[model samples]
Target: MATAGPTPFDPAAEFDRQVRTLTELGYPKLSGLAPERFAALLEPLRATALTAVAGEAAGEYDPESGRVPFVLVVTRELAPIEETMSRTTLHGGKLPGFVDRSFEPGALERFVATPEARHPGRHAYLILEVERGEEFCGSVPLDAMATIAGRGRSLLTIEEGVALITHFPQVLVKNKCFSLGGSRSGDRRVPAIWISQKAPKLGWCWEGNPHTWLGMASAGDRRATAGSSGS
Candidate 1:
């Protein structure tokens, strides 16, 4: 018997492959929260405005079990407001505007700095866990993973993390979205990839290509046998 050589990595091609796989797996419809709904979810941070963004359909197939997981692209924008009663109450003093003029860019960082900020604004992805006969799990932010892990809170399993990236590849790709400085000339867009169980224990890592090597982690060895759908 002869072993096959590793396949060459091509970011663009891998992205197209994942998107195509998602579509074929039956993730045809994409939905997102309206601006009002987004705002409601971000109500705690009244100074922050949430704008739901457009998303694409995605799906992944498990070759081992012949199962397919599907998902939708969902995004939200946060704009910092200068004043809010909530901020005044939390900080014990009226602080400056939530939006920092000196920062120039990186809205997500600004969101995390505020005393009441629950999440990082830029390049941050939130995952909502769904389990049968259970209330919807609270939103989990990707940037806060280390903190959560440090605190020894087993709030999320590796499988959940994998599911998150599978459903929202945009989160990984959009990390550097603002690096272009508003210049649209000859800019290159990163491709997205979906990590299946056959790929690695890192759940699913995608950024342009499956081999691009942006980051990796052990999501653990948790498996879903059947009737699992990305909702």
Candidate 2:
């Protein structure tokens, strides 16, 4: 059989849908609140949604190799009522509830710096906060796979990462790290796409919007290839 074509990925549309869901569920309106306050409300919700979609936390990091390494932290709680409320409201009852956690800012910076230090490819980072005080942050180290292209390791890139996200919208929750991106308005649009995983998916009590911030960039090799062709 012929392979299927790649699915269309619309970060803005997905974000709008989630915001609408949250509005319907009675959560505070994201647009009206201050940036910091809005982020605070969404963090927990993002954690719950991620856990619901990606069972167990699967992450990658190297503590000894770089000045800063990417980290993924997962937390669980007995009850996640707040998480559930956020999920149900945002996803229109399609997601489940989760425990609570908070996403540290700047977590992505650490993740990005790690791979860039050792590899020659470009990369981007996305942070997804879940409903249950949990967080799931990821880094798309573009083109770094070339370093291990023949080493038998699975090559990962930002495009592939975005594709994975397109299929599983729930990797937004889980916490544990420093804050790289400051809480600001322009920061919201830093990435081509951004996702905020909400409650009704995971039940946990906590304030702040647990969300996934998606950042994008061209792979180093791809950029170099394009530059060479143009010359």
Candidate 3:
């Protein structure tokens, strides 16, 4: 069977979808901001050039290749991380999302951005050049991190990973999930997302471990944006 191609890039449509999803999910309440204010907060990023680039198999993507693109990350400031995961769904929105019990309270908060991973530092922004790193499947995350950095690409954080799935849940297919090695708690645990019992799960794996089915997720770069801007 032939594989399907990457989803077409459409910053305008995606921005609208995200705004709608966030509003319907009651994001304004989560951010402690009025609906109008919340919408205003996202206005600036309307101009972000969410250009899509060619993706290579697991280990083949070039860190230097042209701009990589995907997803708008509403940082922890605007939307709580765990709550975002809980509100996410998969399988045509039928199955609800959940975090692993092994993640203690504040556990997700413990993970921070690695040097390789950069963001715009805004309440809400875009993550560009997103790649699932399927080529690194069966490779240890620590090894994958070194390789990704060596290539000048940044690893995807737990937030970025969640954002990817939130907008494109279809990416979490069986035997091809991804690890968020960029978000480290200063130990062995590597946050990841995968399909579980027909549902989506936010969990973790060992940095030094290798799973034939899991690859580390990464992106080309991140940009900070503000005010309402668009194509």
Candidate 4:
């Protein structure tokens, strides 16, 4: 018998994967709706279409041109940051996610989108072209922000960060995590995702600080078509 060829990359399958992930993670309950209802909210987005981005790895692709790597991001409108963070998993689901005490109530809400990183404000959507920013490892978040902006890229938002790890837990590996620079609380805290004790963590770092294991995550664009019934 002949060996089977490699599986083709399918955007529709990828979209289904994201929808299934969310439903299995109890996103519907968190969104105060039934699982079927929540899934319905996302079904229309499948028709939004995708421009396939080709890349074998995170840092190998060009962030400035062509279609870059992308991720399906369900925004904060569906779930608060703390709830979303707790839902994220890693280490094969052996560890619970954490939200540092320093965050306090409403602290995360203060982290609004930067002028350069405006999003569609949809409940769920695709982060059209994203980068984990492994190439910026050891670079300060603030400095990396400048470079990302200069290159016309937007930083990843807190919700987007959670969504990335939720769907692609493997991306939160040691020595190659990423910061959510697109969302800022107007001080120095830059929300980031890193491996902690072999489990995924939702934590923060000083914008001016640099860590050998951390880099600033960015995106080429955010795309969400308005649902016929409104977002």
Each candidate's lDDT (Cα)?
0.24, 0.26, 0.74, 0.75
State the lDDT of candidate 3 residue by residue for 72-166, as single tens digits. Answer: 78888778787888877873667778898889988988888775664666587777668888888899888998898888878888888888887
List RMSD in Å for every model shown.
Answer: 20.6, 16.9, 5.6, 5.6
**Model 3 residue 184 lDDT?**
84
lDDT of 1 by residue, 1-231 (tens): 352333443323333444454343333322133544543442332111111111111322221121112221212232222211012111112221122233235432222111211222331222222111011112122332333335432232222323333433222221111110011112222111222221212212212232322322211111121221111
Per-residue lDDT for 116 in model 1?
18
TM-score of 2: 0.22
lDDT of 2 by residue, 1-231 (tens): 352333333333333445444445333432355545544544443433343324223433221111111111111121122332233222123544332233244322222222321222122122222111112223332222232233332222222223222223333322321112111122331222233354322111111333333222122121111122100
User: What TM-score goes with each of the models?
Assistant: 0.21, 0.22, 0.83, 0.84
Order of the predicted models by lDDT, top scorer first: 4, 3, 2, 1
Candidate 1 lDDT (Cα, 0 to 1): 0.24
lDDT of 2 at 198: 40
Give the candidate number with the greatest TM-score.
4
Model 4, 111-174: lDDT tens digits are 8777766677468776766778888889878789899889977888888888888877756767
Ranked by TM-score, the better of candidates 1 and 4 is 4
> Once model 2 is optimally superposed onto the true structure by TM-score, how far is the C-alpha of residue 169 displaced, in angstroms?
5.9
User: Which regions of candidate 3 fall more than 4 Å away from where they truly are?
Assistant: 1-8, 50-68, 226-231
TM-score of 4: 0.84
Clashes within 3 Å, all models in order: 4, 73, 14, 0
